[model samples]
Target: MSHRFRKPVNIMPTPTIDLAGPVAGIDTHTDTHTVAIVTETGKHLATDTFPTTSNGYQQVTEFLSAYSVVAAGIEGTNSYGAGLTRHLIGHGHVVFEVLRPTRALRRRDGKSDPVDALAAARQVLTGQALSIPKDTTGPVESLRMLQITRHQLVATAAKLLTLIKSLLVTAPVTVRQRYATMTTTTLVMTLSRCRPPADVTDPVNGTLTSLKSLATTYNMLRAQCDELDNKITDLVEVINPAMTQIFGCRAVTAAELLVSLGENPQRIRSQAALAHLWGVAPIPASSGRTNRHRLNRGGDRQANAALHRIVLVRMRHDERTRDYVQRRIKEGLSKKEIMRCLKRAIVREIYQVLCLGRPVRQSSGLRSDEFRALRSKKGLSQTQVAKKLGCAPARISDIETGKRRLSELKLTYEEFLKTA
Candidate 1:
């Protein structure tokens, strides 16, 4: 026997139940959002759909306001739901990130917009989802957009370079022989400067034209990447000069860390949270007589990569790090084990710098008393001094207190005296 299944029908308007101060959940999509409202005690009050636009967002707010919405759970706040989440937050609604429904639950309850929305609301009501969405209205957002653009340009340029090389391999022997021995940089420049014969009927002419075109594009992309690099450097320097001053923390690495942490690094709550966000925190893998921690394979892989780079640089160049590694090696720890420990330590160091806003000290050949005298004589506050010198106030304080070198100040006493 054959069976036919009917599609779910949406014939009912949004139901408004008699309840005060209800909570809402949203299942977000590209063009629309499904909202479910429930009372504080877990009673379903209403379910509605709204378009994903300014007017629709306002209408959803007004609809939720009718029931005195206390809080809301939203799915995909980083993606499809980002706009709605921003809208809801702007209107003072407490928003929680709702996890997607499990496959088991989907099988049992059947899958639909209303069903997922209801599930999200119930998840929030029962305290199942508790993550606060990231604040995307700051410098980090600007950095993220630039990074994404640069990444796309780089990928395109790489593909074009690969294609150019592949074409060179198959071109006429004379053409291939002329280019095969050249270094990549020289080859790109040579191809870009080529004057292809203006004859499409010839294979060599066609190959030369293609190579020249792609090489020109590749050079343009390289120029764009350089421009992006400069912008990223300036922005990172302005956002936190100390960040770039850290060992192995360049503009790209700093930007990745800032993007991973969001604007408010305090949202991390603790060192463990920071470690977990970077995916460097160890996971317990204990069973029976064996007790050990396994490497975490989740969290922001980009942030994890930044941490890895820091570890590798320190291992190769920093004397203290080298000594520590040797000690750990003597204690029977493998290189991987030592690296894990080093990554965790680096995470702690970066967390302090990023979250606490600590400044790095550079050498300025002057005594502590001279530094303090110069600042006081100029009638400048620590903040004013920090601003003039382009360092952190904490670094200024350390300089004056003899905890840090006076050379740490960007301006030496002689320069400041002259400016005064």
Candidate 2:
């Protein structure tokens, strides 16, 4: 059954404190922290600066205890502001991660660290910062950390690949061209079939040796990354089983979704809040009948990358995705419009994963076991798959590799009678 997306508001939160007297707002940086303490009567109780470390945390807590602070306002609790927020919570302080105002707020009041801190204090003072969610606690933190590390590794892999390609051009005899597409096993096999060219000059020999060392280092890093990725994927399966069940979802997509969910579901008010946080939520730009908002150019770029992986995978692997997007194209929707729809649907899935405490969608029939069974029973040769599907053998090879999907074709006969 299809599901409706929900942005769940905590229907129940015990407001234990009336927040009398004073409130403190904190702004943190890598090196230092600035905090503003203001009383109910608009008097400056105290403004203190502390180093952003364990010592600073101690000092901040001592300052809070002096005034018996009702609550704290902290800027960017999920990003730059997170360390302080978590630190304060660890020390038993009720903290609200304050949201920065849009450009309009800046134009009106001006921007400064003191002003930002005071604004955070004011948000708590006025009950304006009630929308923030609490951190999820433990397991989510592991997933988020794994994702951050994986991303770094993947980006490094790309640069390493470029280096490998360059070395291949300059030192072609050291490794065969076929090794370019092969993994370490196949790479060694390809190398074993050839020998280093004797035509190499002394300088070129040194360079080739360096390239070999680089390749060794690259393989080690890649192996380490793969091991970490495996652990992260396994952890995701345990923490959020639904992650393993979603249609068109892969291990990478599941890991990313888990990371984006963070340590707490309560940290986000709803799925729409998440969409906005990730910058997937479209904005209106209506004026004088122009009615066009440009592409979202902000939000957590890393989070968006995770979502993009999901979209690209769906576009390539899931026939349902192709049908939906193709239908949009047939109706003359712009590429951007179709992409927007895909992003929204992904956000909907994200909501399900977080709120329901499920890591992914239900299995339904989207299992590898089922996929393999269908493939075997189809009994369709490569030539038939290519001919009937109106594609070439190489293209058909890619589909089987799971690198691409057969475009504009019916399902193989074993699957055709199974479902639409």
Top candidate (TM-score): 1
TM-score to true structure, per model: 0.79, 0.71
Candidate 2 regions exceeding 4 Å error are 1-17, 78-81, 99-116, 126-137, 171-201, 288-294, 358-420
Q: lDDT at 325 for candidate 1?
A: 91
The TM-score of predicted model 2 comes to: 0.71
Where does candidate 1 have its weakest 10-residue lDDT segment?
1-10
lDDT of 2 by residue, 255-278 (tens): 666666565665565677777767
Cα lDDT tens digits for candidate 1, 96-143: 887899999999999999999999988877775357677787788788
Question: lDDT per prediction?
Answer: 0.81, 0.67
Question: What's the true lDDT of residue 228 in model 2?
Answer: 82
